[model samples]
Target chain A: MLALHAPASGGARLTAVNVAAEAVGLVIGDRLADARARESELQCHPADLAADRAALRKLALWATRYTPTTALWADGEAPDGFFLEVEGSAHLFGGEDALARDLGERLRGFGLDPKVAIADTVGAAYAVSRYSLQRLVIVPPKGMRDAISPLPLAALRLPADDCATLFRLGFKRIADLIGKPRAPLTARFGALLPLRLDQALGHAGEAIRPQLPPPAYQARLRFAEPILLQEHLIVATTALLEKLAPELERDGVALRKIGLRFFRVDGGVQSLTLGLASASRDARHITALVRLRLERLAEGLDAGFGFDTAVLDGLAVESVKTAQPGLAVQARALTEAEHRARLVDVLSQRLGAASVRHLSPRASHLPEEAATPLPALHGAPPAWLPPPRRGPRPPFLLPRAEPAEVMAGVPDHPPAQFRWRGVVHRVAAAEGPERIAAEWWKRPETPSTRDYYVVEDDAGRRFWLYRDGLYREAHPPKWFVHGLLP
Target chain B: MAPSLRPAAPPPLPLARTPTEALVNLRQTIARLEGRPVAEAAVPVLRFGCPEIDDHLPGGGIAPGSVNDIVPVGYDATPAALGFALALLAASQGPAALVQSRRLEAELGQPYGPGLQDAGIDPARLLVVSADSEADAQWAVEECLTAAALSFVVGLLGAPLSPTVGRRFSLAAQNAGHPLVLLHPHDTAGSNTADTRWLVATAPAARDRFGALGDPRWTVTLQRNRNGRTGQWILESGHGPHRFRVVETLADRPLPAPATIRRRR
Candidate 1:
């Protein structure tokens, strides 16, 4: 026999009792001393509220597989219990009764005894699931009134003191308070009496917000015993992916990002996310991607006792349709491009999203300002103009110009001889200075002007050099090698 | 999924006296016999309208699905190589990709969208991705080459590529029928396997009526040609409707600025 003790007015009281303790007439809320007096051999363990709350939260998140909308039924209202609004989702498991059976069977695997009920109203469902002798009562739509009529007045979800007050008025059953007028009930027991009753009867709407947005596609697997091997995890992942493929296909969408969650037996969760450069729904590709990511983090993903649950979710999705081919010979398989995209997806998974990029040109006159580098999956490519009809822009522009020493003929002439970065170059043929001034309004610090010259050395190597500021203004303007022309 | 059936190829026809008229007749007959529409043969090459530039390139222009290299010859040739890369990207069909490392992007002044747009490469069609290192950039390029969505991919490598990496990129590009142009500084061109390697250098800029700088120009020297003879051309852009033109003269001869004088106090 096991008993959970919590601090109470009478020192400590039994908050919960196992079946053996219950069989011996040890009801909950009884003082610990009284329970000991009744059954001297009973074992009592101090209740850990924090641990219990954490366990409940984990269970709530796990229930998201059955329905996206899952929430705690408010503290004290349903201790260690949650609400899963499985309105349109019950069919996935056959029906509400089947879903309840499956849920109970799976939860029992986790060593939990769960009470599940399906009703049109949350209040009625809560009351019936907890008090019904069957442990599973599914109330059909519009049947909430009769379904909860036999339950005690306490089943209305009211505070304990208020339920006792109603009981004192000879209203022991919920049916007894149903016939009474609302005004008299409020005048005596308060407005909550009728309001709670109305809520349970499905006459008023109750809001239950989801913890997060529901995944477009999701599948979950539970283990009777925790498994630790990476191979076993991969097997489980493949099975879940197979289950999820049909759902994605039905929606005519492919997943861009998939997330895997491992629920360890020690109450810790390990989540890994895999992103694809292109949308895909292929089970083999998805499984491969998962393996690639897992391989990178295998050592760190400690199975700590082992994982009891594995959940796979399609975190991001994009619409995809089969491409039609013009010729049958080429249509038998993916075109070269589609094949390439799939390869990119595989490589991206292994290398990371930062590896794949697209180069876009921006509208700026400054040599370095002319192009924008963007992440492949993020922003759209910018609009393009026709190729320019001018001197070729350097393939690469140094972030900053490197200083150089130069000897030139007369004032502001192209460098006749120069030394840059420890190398001396003799000028063969040089072009004139193309003056480009700083945008003073934008950058006040660079009020100096730049005189750029395209100079080719005797070795056939061309360099874009600039003398910063005028010679008269700064003694001798500093010369810099800004770029190397191929 | 099972593939839809393809109509069989048309039977071979006899040679005709008038080739052009016979070709038209054969195409119409093939279309009629297939009972389905047939598309025109895809062009294997892209011609840059300018004769001087086209005359030097194999097949008279750029190959649609091949690897090319643009190596900067000197200090300021990086921007020229980047410009030529963008110009090729602009001319290529479909979306393009640019893969470089963060260090390279920083060293080259992260390409500004406005500048790239002005250079003629549509900013919208470009997807730029920065890798953690130079090796990663090459790997990214190889991966991006496999994606059929991109018409081409451009990789900026600061160092020479190992034979394995170069071969991998070349094979991937060829298999995917996608072009890849690697940009490397001249000094680092070691054991490159690209079909063509152009040494790009900044040439003299063209002058407008007011003597201001006009369209940019580059002296593109074909350093390595696998299928054609080596040659050099001075390519200019932004003149009239023709976006590119090869000029014969090396210098624009701009009027020199007046000499400055110092007044002693």
Candidate 2:
């Protein structure tokens, strides 16, 4: 006999009890000491509500195979149950009865004793699944009221105090409130009783928040036998893409993000998401991209037992114009822009989109702010303004300027020499003190003004150095090497 | 002599007409053996536009569809090598990709946008790939070479590459008909399959008429040439129509004071 205990105001109370513990007269909410007295052989453990909810969520996601919409029952302290909106998907599993049986059998295989219930409404299903005597119950359409009428009033999912109040008022079954007038129930139970009944009987609409949003467009394939090899996975992916491309082509739409889901036979799921730089419906191009990603994960894609189902979902899509074939006899090769876009897509797929970037000039005088690196997938970079007629900028800029030791001839003049990175170099020539004041508007606590200089060392290697603040300041101005000019 | 046997040596086997022609023939044979295209004329050349440097290079310039290596003379001279490589890319007349590893970026810094524009390269035409490791950077360079739209690819690597990887890059560049330039640190050692290798160091800049600092200058040495004579020259930027010009050699200039004396002063 096993029981899970949780801390309560009084003491540690049993939150859950197995059949044997319950058969020995140890009920939930009983303190651990009393429960031990009732059953000396009882084993106790602390309940981990978080881990339980996570497992339930995973089960909910796995249930997506039967239907695209599944939601965890959110009214309880911890969600121990979930709902599957399988009205449209039941036919795929032969019937509602077969779907429920299959679901129950699968859950049982995972060592879970599941009580499956199906109805037209989520509330009715939730109530019947928990309160019904049979392990599996299928309420036909329009049969929700009769199926739930005999259940206790607590099955309406009201608060325990309200249930106790309703019981004191002699309302034991849902049938007791079926024919009642709305005013009296609202005055007594504060409108929850009538609302829950209306929701369960299909008079009111209740929205189910699915774990995953439905795909814009999706294609599914169920294999006759499970396959585990990477080669087979690629083939399956290609086939799924082919099936998806036509649907996208029909609507003159292209997908920018694709999600490939592999449902393993042992109820594990492996999913891969591929993002494209440009919207595309070309199955071959997309398959090549997917192949690159798969090749990268060749050793990591664990196929436990095998995957029996593969689903390709277009998570994000955009409309695109279909190009008409040219009258020329032979097709033309890819244009320069197309080649560039394809290269970005391939590189981004393998090395990730963030690593590939294009530099664009920003209109800021601050050296670091003067330019920005943007992901290459963002399309062609904007045109840069002609370079200003100032001292040349260095080809390489340090991420942050480093302090340098300087020896200057005059207080405000360029340094005669400076030491950087433990190397002391004598200056051969110098340019200027191009004063750049900090933007006070941008940063309220403005930094000191900088006196920039273009200085060349004796080796002919140019550096962009600057002196911070004025020489008269309490702290003598500091010198810093900002960039390297070639 | 035929009566003396050997059929008169088969009419001297049609010997090469000139020494240069024989050299070209030998180069083509070597290229073919290395799985490179044998047609010399079909390969495009980028001339330095100054005859002094151009004349020493085969075909009057370096081939665009080949691998080239640029190494700095010392750790401090890396900026010079980077400058020379960027000038080559700018002169290539198309978009270019620059691949650099994170370690290299940390050591030498990242490429700046306004700086590139100042050096005559449009920032929009340059794509930068910052890889996490040297291996990934090399892979990115190989991938970039496969794009026909890019005229060239540059890899700024912090570590030396294996000969096999270098050979693979060479083959990839040749097959894709794109030029590739790899910049290595001063300590990098070992042979590569590059068609040309340049060792670069900063040279004293010549002041303008007003005695101010002048255009950037580099003493570039053609350390290895598979097809032409190897030589060294002082090259300067921002002078001639080309990206670089040959600076006139000063025969009687006095050497500057030694570093120790300069520091004492």
Candidate 3:
């Protein structure tokens, strides 16, 4: 939200001359004719709040690597800067001095001529930056006042005209106003001057209302016009995506899914969602993928005099390699397996990645010795663990539904006739006593041994059944449906 | 109404040598489709994990792509209704979705997320979904069970379940190859929705009296199993203390089934 203004000239003129006024005195505002005649050496241009605020927001996002709470306050003629209060929390990046250095370095890296100061109060820090004893100032609590004493009264955050009036009254430095009565000052000028003084001195609290709430990770972008048209919505959404894509990248995050919330000026909310085949950050590609889905949503949009805000949300954020390119081609070839995978991928977007999954086989010979389940957070199974090759498998795994009744021989003998699924099927064909023992290491005292059979009924249906325990035990072997046959 | 089954990918632990070879004999018995001859169809492999339990299950374990249903006994009375839930959920592939009634939150704690994590299943992957009533649980179960790739779909009903509902879930489990694990409080005195029901409670893994420093054990009473045997065994649940212990053996105590069964196998 910060807005940075250049000197009458741009960056090169910044150091050479503190030439702020001569340019403003030139032909930019209402007195263009008179200003032009007055200062022939003037170079004038309209302020670009749009680009400046954009830059500050980028810096704020980058600062998130510092703390989740970062806000930008830029709504005046002052050149853009951050209102970051790294007071108690400043030590995280190695105390105030180191945090200042880091913040300045990062802003510079982002192509902004940055200066930072950590003071007891934001007003004091702003004053230090405006007219300061040192760049990247860190005002330790005990000497915080000394840091701003020599600075001009305007640095106290007063209106330009009021500061001039205060100066004319012989208030040359902040020291001159220290013991002054507040009632008269408020009666004469606005309350802002005294309020700014209290704020600068750390008496009055100065809060920077952040763009987001505590730990609200979602980022938002707004449009200038009240946009009712879908095309305009698309354009604004694209801009937001462009901004969001990089922030997500820096965090090493990919978008498993994202939601776009359109907050209409009329107070209605509409959301559109996109689930990725894999998490990604490329704005152009995400926009393309999401826009197709958005087109289908035109019928659902309720404009209500147009939306003024657009919010892009990354609800499913899994850390990933930020520099990943698009994978639409990888989602190609259209094989049947690939098609099934796409179904799961879509399900993940709606229910989250952890909701969709597959099973892993456990090593055991017991007829019941089979598989375990794990959350399939990743989309494609890496080639490392190749899926089991299609093998001899039953058509229907019996509903471990209910244990069946059977009349059979010995503990391990295949059943001659078994009652399952409420129906009787005589065993026409059967296979041997394949024995499966328990994992004694896991379960020490439990009785073990599974006598399994691969049996065929008279009707050609195959059955997977087992008898619990051994035939030698006094308890008769129990009949259970383990799995089904094709 | 019955839920549909959907096939889902699960962890693929390497198969041991014995089961792989045994599958050769069972291959012709249970092919993927009867329309095709056994020689043409893939071998029907049923991997029943842990030889003991598979001892009673038909076909040994479940067919690789087949689904199953487990309804723990005394779920109605067990304070750790989530114990059976997490046991099954921990072993699932995609995610273990719990479509629960609101009452579960009060007993299991406000947020079921942490408890799920403590039980060894990652809460992030757990979809602790909510439904208004048993009908909703049935609907969600049906939806989850119908997918061809699903591993299991459990419907924890608040009320006693109907045989028709059980049949519906069975049909869905068959289609999707996804197993369903349902939990009902002690109030569920006369309903059955699973192949097996174990009266379960999470207990000290071992007698702390010996200063054992691990998790507790679970005492499970086998109320009913579709295979026609009833028994009680104790198992410790946690890695340290969770060895299941069979304090009382209703195991040898035989109980006649309410009605004679006619199995379709």
Candidate 4:
């Protein structure tokens, strides 16, 4: 694939760099001018950043199905790929060694020139993947620095000029600076190199960083015997929660989100995450959520009568104030909102995270787009007052905004008549043309302008409607049926 | 000095008078759900980039002691809502939890982490959690909210979530000071009973020239809320994930404020 798509002006030709790697007549950074002069037939194509970004994004998207902590090393102009932190599930592809081979083969099959290395750090992995050319090495967590020390300076994610200068200074290997004093390195090469070195060696935090972290809570147990009962797992989790509760409490934290991890005897991590309607650091609250999830797990807490450890995290927490007694609303019955919140959370545990949502109001005049839906667990309170008095709202709002008929009206006047769900309904009582202009103040692509109206049908079914745009033949001022009023 | 930096004395434990003191808040899913109802209180509002978010939250923001989480399309996918949540929490006076994953990628950048702090969450209150598998993610969700320590918990899960799990977690969140927040992408299979499930799609940022999150049109569907009314809220175009601001029910749409808001998606 690389050779076929090398570059083409009218026809195709091999790039100078490939020819150099093949012929050994020259090397990278030897001066493109020099290489061109030596091999007049070499074809050169300027690097395409946009193409690289697109490819990287595509690859990232594909990688995401596997894990959320993938990191790309395609910064700057280097074709250097990325480092995926598959630490926990590396075995899903059949252990680390097999994972490396499978990933490399898969990339090859995808027509990507991929070299993979299972290393501990992003820098080390990048170096091994880039320079290990012949083999994909799986460096055990504790023993990675030595494996990378044998590679050249180019593997350090450093610049070519700096690499050459380091080689000239006899600092050829990553080990050369191991025990050396920092003053000389600082004085000679400035502080950046040392910082980079520390980051690579894990002494300094490289902070590759995840887009959105998983959770912060963790529960674990070191059992004397592997118990088969699922209750044991609960006990183990309780033990770990005991350890974590204090920290959370001291920090004024709560668990709205959590992750339960089970590091089995055979070197594997099994986990379950629970989301809550409210956040708290109380362990029992977390345990209840987990009990429901664990019970439904396909594996069903099997421990072969003996297991090693169980852990939990996803420390999803929220803050609550320590208000003085009688300072807030008095203790009251379970409000409808609270009941619904519990129901939503229970439903999520029974169904899935996206199954439940709350009706949130929107700024759009478009009915379907008028009020938004949010995760029940994360949604705000239900509105207590009446639905918007704007115009006529429909009785039901579909997942997607379905087509509705447009009636004649300018601004706040009720529409004369409209067709909905195939039937035409006549307007009985008319109230408005609640002008819901586009949110143009924020974006250029906003709707031209929308004029929403609330019109009650003769049958007493209040329907919310809106015009997509002001009357215009070119654009056809379309209208839509939005929401329903009780 | 770190010890000296601590407050002279934390006065007294305020929760000592409540039933919570006697109950062994075992990090259970049903712990919060099974307990007596907690009354509505004046909770500190967490301003999501969108005003609609604030509107749904008790007190016009995420009510204190609520559990919430994000579901992205996948790990590599952008957790737009998660980002917005973090920014809101970071700008808050309390701490926030950042759950970690073991499969795909792992790096917590200051540039991104502080985006929440920049908005208003207390950076000092941030917590980081890493779970090895899906089950662990669920357990962590319950654990964080069951405890009265953390202010918020954020998670990135492999699946959408089930109804049972959602209820238990919500219960845990109520009693403790913490709230659970997760990021479940679109691909997270199955159903869930989340208090508010937001279906966030991408839209161009409003003013960010060099790739910043502007006011993206999020198709926020209130899958579950009181009154059985599901709808969407159009957030104004702005600049980053947190830049999208919710527009009011223009002209004359005013919903009766919820008395006790326990969830805010």
Model 4 per-residue lDDT tens digits across residues B1-265: 3556655553233344555332222212133344544434445545564655554543344555554444433332243444444444554554344554443222222112122223333333443444556666677566556544446677666555678887777767667655556666557632354544544443222335553222333334444442124445544434345555664332224555787333432
Provide the lowest-lDDT 10-residue window in model 4 chain B.
B105-114
Per residue, candidate 2 scores C-alpha lDDT tens digits across A247-355 of: 8989999988899988887888888998887787777788888888887774857788898888888999989877788999896687788788888988888888888
Tens digits of per-residue lDDT for model 4, A304-387: 435555656655577755434565677534444444445446545644555344445455544445444455577553342233
Q: Candidate 1: where is the Cα deviation over 4 Å?
A: A1-55, A66-69, A75-79, A85-121, A128-154, A159-178, A187-191, A201-207, A212-486, B1-65, B73-76, B91-94, B185-187, B200-211, B214-221, B227-265
lDDT of 1 by residue, A408-475 (tens): 86578889999987889888667768777777877757567878887766644567788888877647
Q: Pick the candidate with the highest lDDT.
A: 2
Fraction of native Cα contacts kept in each candidate?
0.40, 0.81, 0.00, 0.00
Any runs in candidate 2 off by more than 4 Å, and if so which? Answer: A8-12, A31-33, A76-78, A295-299, A325-332, B1-44, B189-191, B239-241, B249-265
Better of 1 and 4 by lDDT: 1
Sorted by TM-score (best first), the order is 2, 1, 4, 3
Model 1, B1-265: lDDT tens per residue?
9887998666767578896557545754665685523322364455567866565565566665567888887745776677777777666766777777776665574554544555555556666666776766776787778777677788877778898988887778767776788888668773357878888887656456665444567888877765456777778765234666776533332345656332211
Clashes of 4: 248
lDDT of 3 by residue, A116-162 (tens): 77777788888887677566777788566788888878788677788
How would the docking of model 1 be graded? incorrect
Give the better candidate number (1 or 2) by lDDT. Answer: 2
Q: List the residue pairs that clash in candidate 2.
A: none
Per DockQ, the best of the predicted structures is 2
DockQ of 3: 0.02
How much is B209 displaced in model 4, in angstroms? 60
User: Candidate 4 lDDT (Cα, whole model)?
Assistant: 0.55
